[model samples]
Target: MQGGVMRRRLRRRFGLGCLLVGIALVVAQSAAAEPRRLEVELSQLFDRLDSGFSNWQGQRLEFQSARPGDPTWYGAATHDRRYGVEDEGVSLGAAVPLGADWVLQPEAGHTFDADFLPRWYADLRLQRRLSHGLVGALSLRRTEYQASRVDRLALGMERYWGPWRAGYTLNVSDVSTAGTPVGHALALDHYYGERSVIGLRASLGREEEGLPGGEAITSEVTAVALRGRHWWHPEWALSWELGTLSQGDLYDRHGVQLGIRHAF
Candidate 1:
């Protein structure tokens, strides 16, 4: 993860994580945002990026075994780029809950960039129920990306109003490439029925970078998405998302995702 590629990888992971959470919540039962019993999930996402200079296509696959408030393990594979000099990799990780309000996740993987590089990451989060319809979370995360590393701190809050739920997240990251990046995300969801939901999400960010010879560059990123999920039976659910991204004014991308989950 050197220079521009590092930033790209970080952004991709950010968007994917958010999409997964949104989908799970939408497909959840009326009383919970995730399956309370043993569950398995599979997901796929595809994106195309156009930067007026080059075109990049990305595809990702994820599989997970989950049990709410317990331990969960996941595996993911990502392929991004059309040319031979693309980024492709696989990751494996696990999340374990500590007590009622804390979760710790650790992951290790490898990526085949110019060569093969080892990657590892860890996340620790604390979530609390604030009031009748409010919840808040604070988290810290670190990623060791080949030659570069990133450290991030984030805060998030969610509020429930009637059939609607809204959330906001703010984060700052210390990137090994360029400098630091600051971002915020907003999400709004409406539960149409007991087992169906629709959601809208948007995110914005600014990253500062330092070039050779003391030059500086500022990168801006924006993402917007629409998603929905429904449970057709007590044990099966489906989710989908469509999204677009803009990196500065020259780069733009569009993506689609689909997922299925089953509880036993």
Candidate 2:
């Protein structure tokens, strides 16, 4: 009888232990089903910014279509076309993260135009996040244009405040025909809710023209862009953007773009 009693006691302890283990597993599975705190997105854009008047009363257009993907690593391909002119180009780029706080981006492109020789260009960029709200970047670009070559370096900084973000870019460039010039740009961006954003950007720069003794010219470019997006499900979204660009002695150009994106 004592042996039977001890056997029942052992069986009870074993079953109780299994019951506790099953409850713990249920709790772990519930926790695992919760949403993640971080998010990653990939997107593509088609942009058209144009302004100019010609002797033939034609408008100049710069259109670009690009497919870009972003994760821990990123990549992009872009095709650029000019209207009323036989000029077009394509670019491919990639970005990789080096460590916790730094990223490296490298890009290359080729351009073909009737007025200019086939040109090749390459760029490299380094970026780091300084804090929760601040980021900094440095970039360099080299291009071979016709009989001349151009090299440029740029520095940029950005700050994020709540839903509003602001940034600046400074650039210096050396052209084989026109020496060197410095340029500056400023921009402001606002995010509305989770799926809408608006931005205004302006840039003032000095560029060298390789004609009539290659003089330097000052130019200002201004733009305003608004974008809206709607999420149909967890992995799908519909997006729209409207933008305008204006410059001196140039006709203002306006554009509208719409697309759908899916995340995996």
Candidate 3:
């Protein structure tokens, strides 16, 4: 009996020890032209496997419907918990071709009733295809709450070499009540078999958190994640991710998310 208990403990730790999470399942999470991507995901925290896989304090249910195009407009709704508090929000976004090599993306989200989650958030990004199978992007985001606001700027570059892609991003951020912080992230991914992919990411940075009663804290954070998806059928895919995060003397997080996706 004792040994069985020990095994269970090890099972949980193994996944946590590997690394935390990501905007994982690459091809399975994003829709392709004329095909739609639908996913259901679960993690210990509100971890959306988006381009920015930032984990918040609550669990969430999210759904997205992408419009028809190479990379077009999409809408999403999220009912998530933040710092153990619950909140809900809906978002709409679009990606428009600026020219032959450039694209512009704009998005906005709002919560009917604000809580730990922001009352509203918005962002705009510009991406350009560069020489030598490379892409570059710049983005700015603003998240507003009842009493404080957070702003962020990011610059990124990515390179494609055959079936592999490598990317790096730099982020600078400030909060009305917290200190400024900078972060760095690196990612590598391999694609094959029409719509299957495997990816790994690592990030390190300083983070700011607004506490209750207008207080706040700043800390250093480190995270690593591995995510992948395999399509067993033309219309179905299996997705999974493992991740871990270390925060300066605050807490250590290790978790996983398993999802099923459908292409329609």
Candidate 4:
């Protein structure tokens, strides 16, 4: 009986994740055609996954504001319910531009549950556009977990071909929990005029989870995601994202995110 329930949850999560990702990508691509100075986005996420202990269902609400060449801010509230426990959390983050091509993003948040811990993260990125329709970025990130801290470095490159673009990113991380891990991601997107876009992305990485007694479990993480964006008007757009996360055969999750945005 328990196995049946788990399977059902997994299927639902996968479907929802796909739907959400698809819509988000569509809207984002569409909105990029006529860029706005001030943008507001609201999103909802439905997720199901295992986190070492039990399977949980998460409902998250998020709000974001972005200004091109300036700063972007986001906040989110999440509720997770499982068989044995319920958890809630609120998170906020900001990405601020340091120059024409540098951005610093810092995020901190606290979760309410048995753990009741605060998490902190920060990332610094430098990006530049080349003369030949190419762009590149380098970034470093630090994340503080309850029992461990991790640092990651990434390099990314992108090429633009008319209305289609492709990007690749390579990442490496060092940590006590996950040991040394490496990953990479690829993305491709095509624009249909200035009103719509479709994109696909995939990533494979290694991550560590902290366990009791100062121990950690290392796992391989993989995901494939799709998203799309469409604009109904110059001022309004819709987007969706769908993705599946897998950690070998032991753990799997699917999520869907839906978003709507308006520009001032």
Candidate 5:
């Protein structure tokens, strides 16, 4: 990863991990409690950042507590070192019901002594359950760097039918220096026994790039991944991903991530 693209790739990795967790939890049956309102998860990822910059890696710990059909509080703390610079960040957020089958999620985060990652970040999303197992959502995100800013908007749809879920999303991003670029993502997941799931996701899109010397450009990027989760015990679950990404001809990379989640 190089310069600005590094942040974008990092964001994608985190997003992919969260995606698997979210989808899995939606169908998970804890067997400990009716809802298992309180939960904690620990995860790590290893990536081989090419081009001799540095290897990218991180560990994350997150917690959430909430009851069904009620307001939820969640937070995360992360320690990451990429490009040979170490940074730590924390974020707090909530999921609140807005009536009429609508839901809202808002979060804010800040990185301490940041060099590669954004110094400040915020996101807001609104979603509603539609007819016949369909849901629609819209989201906006902002990331502030030392001397740059990026804003993104996304529209998404998800459908669940007979042990299968499918989703699609379109994202448009605007960089202060680089131009706006659009990306599309699609996913499919199948569930068995309420706690085990397997999924595949693919994304292809254009990304805004600001090179080392204030050179702004747009680049094509594509990624594909297989992710899954299974419950080994009533209160414990395991999740994993294997993925590859390519950005034009700059670099080709493969990575793996694993996580464990528990309810208390």
Candidate 6:
């Protein structure tokens, strides 16, 4: 009887030890299997850029719309007319962790029009975290217009402060006829919540004349946009935006856009 009791006790002790070892192994494996968190977003914008032409100085104003074969000018005698121009663009973007305190994002976008003009853009940015809820980013972007075969490069710095973000971009454009023209842009964006955002962006740029003998023309653009997203499931979402664009002295453009996204 004594020998049997001793054997039973030894068996119980060995069983408990095995269970503990199993639990420890599981905990270690789970820690090793955990994945780092990363965030990515893809967005599209359907908008219009209206160029309101007004008589300023002695220049004969010709207002051209994006629509194909539209009259270049309603009449030189008329000073007030509306030009309706629109563009549809889609962007694919991804953000990933590079290391501690650093992140990198790369994005590409393409725009198509009914008039056989297409635009393509590529951007790469690197961000570093700073103290006091601040972050800084350095970005490089390239844009190409397929119809005209013109290309532009932009270098910029972005700053984040609390819920507000701002950036300045410098652009150098190469035209087939005019050597190169430099432009500058400044933009501001504000976030109201985790999923709601508003942005006010403006850019002042110059474009060389399409014709051989035309001189460089200055262009200015201002835009205000509001965007929001709602998650229906863990991997699915709906997003929407409303925005307005003003180009030079031509016209004001208003647009609304919606999209649905799913993640695998």
- The sequence of per-residue lDDT tens digits that candidate 5 reaches over residues 1-264 is 000000012333433333322332343223334453576778787777566556668777777676545556777788876656677888887767676477687878887866666787898878777777787879899877766777989999888777787889899999886679898988887776645677788888986543332233557878898987676786687867788877666666677878787868
Per-model lDDT: 0.58, 0.44, 0.57, 0.55, 0.66, 0.39
Model 2 lDDT per residue over 1-264, tens place? 000000000100010000111111111122333332222223333344454432111111111111111212222222322333433455454444454456566766665552332366788877776765666878898866666677889998777667666778798988776667777767665655443445555555654322121122323445555554455675565555565655434445555555554544
- Model 4 lowest lDDT segment of ten: 1-10
Off by over 4 Å in 4: 1-36, 48-56, 59-118, 193-195, 209-216
Query: Model 4, 6-66: lDDT tens per residue?
Result: 0001112221111111122212222333342444555556656766645545555555554
Indicate the TM-score of model 6.
Answer: 0.49
TM-score against native, each model: 0.70, 0.59, 0.74, 0.68, 0.83, 0.49
lDDT assessment of candidate 5: 0.66
Q: lDDT tens digits, residues 53-83, model 3?
A: 3445433333334332334445555565435
Candidate 3 yields a Cα-based lDDT of 0.57
* C-alpha lDDT of residue 62 in model 1: 56
In angstroms, the error of model 4 at 171 is 1.2
Q: Local error of candidate 2 at 29, Å?
A: 22
lDDT of 6 by residue, 159-248 (tens): 655656566767777765456777666656565533234454455566432211122233454555554445566556565556565545
The candidate that wins on TM-score is 5
Arrange candidates, best TM-score first: 5, 3, 1, 4, 2, 6
Task: List the pairs of residues colliding in candidate 1.
Answer: none
Using lDDT as the measure, the top candidate is 5
Clashes of 2: 0
Q: Flag regions of model 3 displaced more than 4 Å.
A: 1-71, 210-217
Q: Which of 2 and 6 is the better model by lDDT?
A: 2
Query: Candidate 1, residues 82-101: lDDT per residue as tens digits?
Result: 32246677776655555544
Number of clashing residue pairs in every model? Answer: 0, 0, 7, 25, 0, 7
- Comparison by TM-score, 1 against 4, better one: 1
